[model samples]
Target: MPAFIPDILAAIAMVGVAYNLAGAALAGRWRDTPAKRPAATPSITMLKPLYGPEPELAVKLSGFLDQDYDGPIAMVCGVSRADDPALAAVPATARTVIDPARHGSNAKVSNLINMMREVDGEIVILSDSDMSVPRDYAARIAAALEEPGVGAVTLLYSGRGETNGWSRMAAAGISWGFLPSVMVGLATGLAKPCMGSTIAMRRETLDAIGGFERFRDLLADDNAIGMAVRELGLQVVVPAPIVTHSCTETSLAALAAHELRWNATVRMLDPAGYAGSIVTYPLVWGLIAWIAGACWWVPFVALLARLALAERIDVITGRRTAPLWWLPARDLLSFGLYVGAFFTRRVDWRGAQLHMARDGRMTAEPETRYP
Candidate 1:
């Protein structure tokens, strides 16, 4: 190797460490948008697409049903088959939509298409089955949509491990790694995210975006929806309420596959931004510099920076997902998955193998079952 190579690597690592420190500072400044009830609370229809019985499925779904909002709320849980075990967890108050039809490669979007027929509310909210939110979630969402030029609203999320050790590891990645990065991205005006944690919009806005069918084949359906909403010259806003996403990975393999799929989706959505996210993993780059014969203090500072960011995220979110000592392993594992995402277009989603095209469209392999 050239003698200048170690110097170059160390410089890059130092830059990454600086980025981590900046992210920590940004996280410390984070605040949730105060919940405000709109003067007129429109009727809301929540579409929940379910595949199987995830951990705490009933509890999470019940959180939506017990909202404190005064408006009439109707929730429709969609399942491809009537015999899906997930249906057993649906609350008696929420209606169930059973359709065994495939609209596109994305089963969840297809489920939404079926559930839309039953939607009767002036406002529509689509949330993932694994998320649980606070009592004020509905009121906050409704208030945000009342803002002028707001086409849609999506909530931020924190991770909660609902299963074993591997689940905690997964949650740590989300809360510590993913959450902080998103904060930095939003602050820098580099990200426009519409997550499945909660996507709320008026029925007219949904109709204007051509509904969910336009995103049925896309890998990053939520991002695509946000883009579509933005094309209509309206903003998709993220409010103060942070929903809880239950991480239920039971083993290392399960955790790896799940995160790899997530990283792959992000890469598909914005290849350049995802590639630039290498600076988000300072410890990984610092270790690489150390291996390349850089100074010893490089990796040490990188570790400290990562720890600082993790601590800040925990403080902001008011919850700690894992121990500080577990961060190095989590960061290393995350970096590995980030690298792996670039090498493969195939990802596993709810027990199905999907091939992704450069255009962000997905195709499922033959004989594959979607949950």
Candidate 2:
């Protein structure tokens, strides 16, 4: 390792930092200047499939139940087991169904299939158990999917972790890193993801692609669903942005497991894109600079780049919730996660030992090993 190696690495890191800055700017623009589209037909069925009770789950589910949309609106929330606590928490405005049986490896989609039979709206939107939305969520999603060829619509979410310290950090990771990165990808036509946060679609288009059951075994179900719509030569659109529920990680181990599962899931879906994401971690590259050369200036540059990113993220995503001292440590940990993600092939998801296949199927390992 030579001194010049660090300088080169630092230079490389600056490029990525600049790219992220551009992305942050784009997110701010998207948030501030949401495309104003006239309200369309508002018949929508909001599907939420849940398995457990989470902190603030009541308030989150209630947000959708009390939507301001004037047209027909129905909600079909499912619980994997009849005893799952999530069903009771849903507001009475939405129809609730209890499904104890698992159709395939994917319990969420299984619940979706059961609930879909009961949905009675022209427009359908499915989200996870943890998402929270504004009163106009249904109206906006309906409007976004009004175009002739639009198959599905998704939203980029800013995290809201209301729990503990680690949970807040995890939220920041979503708001600051994942959200902004996705914005950059969309801005550049490099990434097209249909997120579960808010996947709006016409009932006909879902049927055109063989319905949600097609995603039963897929790990990145949302992405696969979006791709299937794409195969129909239909466009998957993303609305301005949405605020989804985020729980506190509560511990470093919890944060690690959470992010690692996500990374492995992405890797199984798109290996090339996952591998290329390394350049996005300027903090990691900066560390390589310091480790390779013992260069004092390399460390300073790393700190500067990281601080710039942190402050920029706060400003762009409207996330100033994190305390002053946590940014530095968070940046370092994020960089480490970026590097380590490349080597992980197995992840623990919902107490399941999931080994990611080259394709997107999450094959379960024996529960005994993980337990």
Q: How badly does each model clash, as a count of residue pairs? A: 1, 3
lDDT per residue, candidate 2, 75-153, as tens digits? 7888756666666688877787876666666667877988877888888888877887777777677777877788899
**Which 10 consecutive positions of candidate 1 have the poorest summed lDDT?**
362-371
Candidate 2 ranges beyond 4 A from true positions: 33-39, 294-302, 365-371
What shift in Å separates residue 87 of candidate 2 from its native position after superposition? 2.4
TM-score, cand. 1 vs. native: 0.96
TM-scores of all candidate predictions against the true structure: 0.96, 0.92
Give Cα-based local distance difference scores for all models.
Answer: 0.87, 0.76
Q: Cα RMSD (Å) between model 2 and the true structure?
A: 2.6
Model 1 misplaced regions, further than 4 Å = 366-371
Q: Candidate 2, TM-score vs. the true structure?
A: 0.92
- Mind giving the per-residue lDDT tens digits that candidate 1 earns over 248-295? 999999998999899998988889999988878878888888999998
